[model samples]
Target: MPAAPTAAWSLAEWLAWQEQLHPKSIELGLERVRSVALRLGLLPARAVTLTIAGTNGKGSSSTLAASIYREAGYRTGLYTSPHLQRYNERVAIDGVQASDADLCHAFLAIEQARGATPLTYFEFGTLAALWLFREADVRVQVLEVGLGGRLDAVNIVDADAALITNIGLDHTDWLGDDRESIGREKAGVLRQGCPAVLVERHPPESVLAVAEDLQVPLLRLGRDYDFSPRDAAWRWQGPSGALDELPLPALPGAMQLQNASGVLALVETLRGKLPVTPAAIAAALRSLQLPGRLQRVGACLLDVGHNAEAAEVLAEHLRSLRPAGRVLLVLGMLADKPVEAFARLLQPLVSRAFLGGLPGARGLDAPVLQARLRSLGMETEACRDIPEALRRALAQAAPEDLVVVTGSFVTVAAALDVLHE
Candidate 1:
């Protein structure tokens, strides 16, 4: 077995070491993680737990729920994956990321407990987050599934409530080929008798079947709960109650209302354990801010949306904005994503496409993306990296025009680093 990480190691060093400990980056199964979690006493989480799983809106939904709980005077612990900026962003307490010392301590504990068992990077992070939450004695915990729900490391914790925000064709290689098959995998987060909130307007039959088989009380958007635009605001009505004149979520995009509505539903389901007032709900909506989800830095908008479904939503938002000059796109994506479909959906809205090569083994090259966009009759330029692509796009963009940086988290992170610099 590889030598155990030293207690003196920094958070960065521990993370780097953990990455190399596992042979495969992603091995979707709960046995190994569950064993380690059991040893750490993380099962049957002491806090009221909410687990969110979906293709597009998991980050937004989980953040909204955690914000609401925080507003309600609860000590909230939130854990999300693939952070845009730092690894610490993956674990938070009351909207504050865990400190380096805190994360390192948790890692040490897990290392000692695991002995010789190997754990994936995500598995290690999940265990660390749970350990920190437990140690902090948090009142509520919001966990976002990293990938598919069933086998995802976060699933080890049976949440008090589960929220599945719309399913789409993403990670098809691991999840499934079609929406139906993927829906089933996402629905695995739901436990029997536990209430589940589904934001999908037209949910697949497989999802419904899982809820039925599990005897889960499913609250679906448009049917069991929904929201509508008021004159200047919006209104959300769910099984528990309705909140009117609700300020729109601070997060951009019309689809956020759907995510917020589902978060409210999840909040309502856990009302018995962690009661939240309508005031807290409204306050949370107005205050929540997630980076890289249609985030605007100066005239450039950065969104970490890579799937075709997300691209479609992005197209609508761009149309609604209707910049006087033109929309320029700086995009980079992983090789496994549906690059052609994503480009095709956004082609009409985009005036010019600047394709940037992403880093790492899974990253697609800029030349490849340029070729795909050119074949679709879209004007394109290829750049060596996202920062280069952003710089070129910004130079070409007029004062009234908007430059959008999107495709993947890594893509947006690169743009953000340069923009902030």
Candidate 2:
């Protein structure tokens, strides 16, 4: 199914135009985007772009890296997928989202460039980001892959640096189930000799083999660099490098430590050329924030972790925060995911689970999902939607108690609109 159109030529016109071009939200093969890119001349001929791909933490890692570079005083551009509150959030320069006028220029450019040929919504946005960044004369561009990297649209532009954070089971229908298969697919972003940074404690051998075959500069965590705790702070050391004591990332959770390390390794690899100072790194992590990733909203907390691996990360963070009273969860997820795994992750941490149907054809029906909550063995209520779920949860809780809304980004955003009100 296609993403339903919701833009004016204003936002709507461009959205409707692009939606008609592509048959699917994701066409895994890169050939169409590559051809259009050549015609549109969208490919970067000469620019230092750091492309990142991973199942989780891609946005956080990109934010941290961009923030550090910006703090160090470089003109940096960041591109991430699936914006929460606004489409503008996907493209940013120095932490500011692109304005609607900028988005208009990009949409028009892509429309003219494509001629009669169609591009996916993601493809259109990728071209727009490149166009906007080039026009703005950005010093660095960090492009996060939207889906599996092997044939994702972003692969059209080769990278000066490529970082693959971690491999996990996701988009299983497109990629394979096994870790090694997924790792090999992700290794697609690596350029022949460009530096590729990885944080896998045990990276799949397939990824290592691909890197070896390509002679890519392999920077592995334990072998090339390592991060470990040092008293109250953390210490990171790279091959031919060491970053002294650093504070924990303000992003919260133990998973962020690994992500922070990856950010450091990438910056460290480009040190003199990128020239980021330790003070800049400290400031970025201390101030870096991404919406709806274990994020606090008024007295309620919201996160966009639906899959089991992400759920595990959310669980660990909740354990640390340990909100003052009994925990309450307002949960919604796609029907295809392991709903059981996510339910288990939250059931242990919260006192009651408020299930709801997310707003999409793929969303799991709330009442249908309720049966899965039985294993949770906790009090559960099925709400009509995210807003209703939030109303129910908030009415039952005191200001200090936990009211968590988790599952998908759509769920978080819908609830966030109410949380802000």
Candidate 3:
């Protein structure tokens, strides 16, 4: 729901337009966007799309797939949601963003195409990403679900290969209250007679049930594809074949190895159609980069682990490092999430807190965060925003101390911006 004059606005101004269009920030279900998409002729791209859905690993899977395909010399497009800093990061081709002019053109195109239908912020953005990908004629497009997969705007395209990374109780309010219910919601993107990869180490039965009922060729981890680490290297085995020797992924987390493994399984699943060479696979594995996943700056660590599930992986990585001094956490989170679980996971790992406000409407107030810290018996400092929080951490931290920014993407994003500067 862009402004009436979106055609006259810049990308930022148009984004502002979209913000006002939807009364609610996030509307879960795909009916409205799907109908608009059908009217706009977007369903055919469904035949060529590989939609990846999950709470934590959707971004990682989409990027990994896009990189592998592009390194193999295929023109590839990658789309992920809730960009950290810039809006353009949500859409890319061959690792570069869709230009501002192109995005503006897309905004105009979607505005024209929507007619009387109202689209959510994510829905409009999804349509724009699809529009850009179709116009550019990329060989393959890797699309990440904005929310639960089944009725998301991205589901309008029937996925050629749908990868459900894992099910978690995220967005429980909209999808359902448990893993089984959430898993069923995520299972919505699977298309019949196509390859569907289940990357979960332990998948819920709901996901498996949907796959069986849909009649898609299911490739399950440990069953259809498997991999392991040995002597600073790893091995992969898939339905098409095996890679006995491979470089460990450069993505900077233990979780990413399994993610890359799934991508290889998918490539193998579509071998003849996609045709990725060993060298390309190796190159993509070596060069793939994600900024905020366990990144380090001098005396500071930053990650975008916003949920308890993600925090577990972050916690393991932190434990391995065993920083000399206690961790000082700079925290912020969205109001809707389970703040208690996120805080609980990091409490033992954290020694104190520098509570701060994140940069959006959904962010938790610094005072509320400070209260949480006090309840845990942790020392607390307050700051206006991320830069001030980091400045405080830098001054207060011993050279041996580790400052971790957690709680949400908004928190990590602010820390990442300062670290880069």
Candidate 4:
């Protein structure tokens, strides 16, 4: 589109300027990005790339994998999307966020290289991250797909191993309205003859068909590999072998075992290239942390679970925690999410729910979400914003009771901001 707003701008100015270039915020396709990437040599050449795509566990799985790689002494480059609080959280090299100066430099280079090619904000950020990772000469690059696997900007690079965490009915408008259609779109990340890991216990036939058609050596959960919880820890059995007495993930959720299992399978798939010791795996599991996914901040527990599947996971986590008192919920959801389904899953666990309005196109109003919960026969309170909702939830909860701020990432982010303040 038009030239960048100004020259020699800061990261904030550059990000705001980039957002203006694309007509739509999220335009999914690779042609425009691929052309610019080819010009800038942004594709991964030397590094081992692992592309992760899913509805819920993608963040945790990617974090586990990247942390293990980092623990193994590899220069790890990770690129995730839709940062909760800071844009800088999206790209990191060797466990450090890319500096604002570094991102600005990369943005300036892409701005010059793209010419008339109108790149979406995500496309530009993806290219910049790849370029930064390449320039840094990182040995292991983990890219999380921003949306559907096929058309997501990160999928432009042919990953050495593709990890599909699990499929759910989120992003139906862009990806299809059902799990099978979503699975087919996610299965696009699988490459012929390359190793692909599907950690979903019951994967869609479309994904299996795509893997078969592409001749992808698929390692599926339950069939190819599985994990079972022991008293305290879990045991992972894969094609490579079984690893017993593994430490539970430190991410504070029972569902993390499922995510960690996929991570372990991917580790096994890439072990030939980047071998990690059992010690490293154990260490990574014990040390791994991801914010806004069942994260605990002071007295408030925060989860960025916007869909029904994620709500199921959150419910499981809350049950495992076994809070002795009431579990008050401060919730805010996007307009497109299955608010009723999510509410149904979590309502039983929640003693009382406070609804808050999130801002932007996808956000649902607080009163609207409160009415939805009330319709579900749940106790509800409506607040103007996440801060107010969190305040009310905390006020309602006793010291023994748990206060959870959840629903969408924006909700968690808002809670975090208010908590930090």
Candidate closest to the true structure, highest lDDT: 1
What does candidate 2 score on TM?
Answer: 0.95
User: TM-score of the candidate numbered 1?
Assistant: 0.98
Q: Give lDDT per model, in order.
A: 0.92, 0.84, 0.83, 0.90
- Using TM-score as the yardstick, the better of models 3 and 4 is 4
Candidate 3 deviant stretches above 4 angstroms = 1-3
User: What is candidate 3's lDDT per residue for 1-421, written digit by digit as tens?
Assistant: 4327555578888888788888987887778887777776777873257889988878888898999898988888899988988899999988899888889898888888778888888988998898888788888999999889887888888777888886776788888988999999899988888988888978989988988898989899999899999877899998777897788888788888888888888777788688889989888888877767787777887888777788888888889888888799888777778777777777788888888877666777787767765666767777888789887988889989999887777887788888889
- The residue-by-residue lDDT of candidate 4 on 1-421, one tens digit each, is 2344545688888888878878999988889999999899775457899999988888888888999999999999999988999999999998899999999989988988999999999998998899999999999999999999999988889999999988999999999999999999999998989999998889999999999999999898889999999988999999978999999999887778988999999999988889999999999999989899888888888999989988898898888889989999999999999999999999899888889999988889988887777778998888999999998887777889999888888999999988998
Report the lDDT of model 3 for residue 321: 88
Model 3 collision count: 1
lDDT of 1 by residue, 1-421 (tens): 2366788999989989988999999999999999999999988899988999999999999999999999999999999999888999999999999999999999999999998889999999999999999999999999999999999999999978999988999999999999999999999899999999989899999999999999999898888999998866999898867888999998999999888988988888888888899899889999979999989899998899999999999999988888888999999999899998998998888899888999889998999878766778988999999999999999998899999999999999999999989
Comparing 2 with 3 on lDDT, the higher-scoring candidate is 2
Q: After superposition, how far is residue 185 of candidate 2 from its true place, in Å?
A: 1.5
Clashing pairs in 3: 46-158
lDDT per residue for candidate 2 within 124-172, as digits (tens), equals 8988888888888888999999987879888989888888988887777
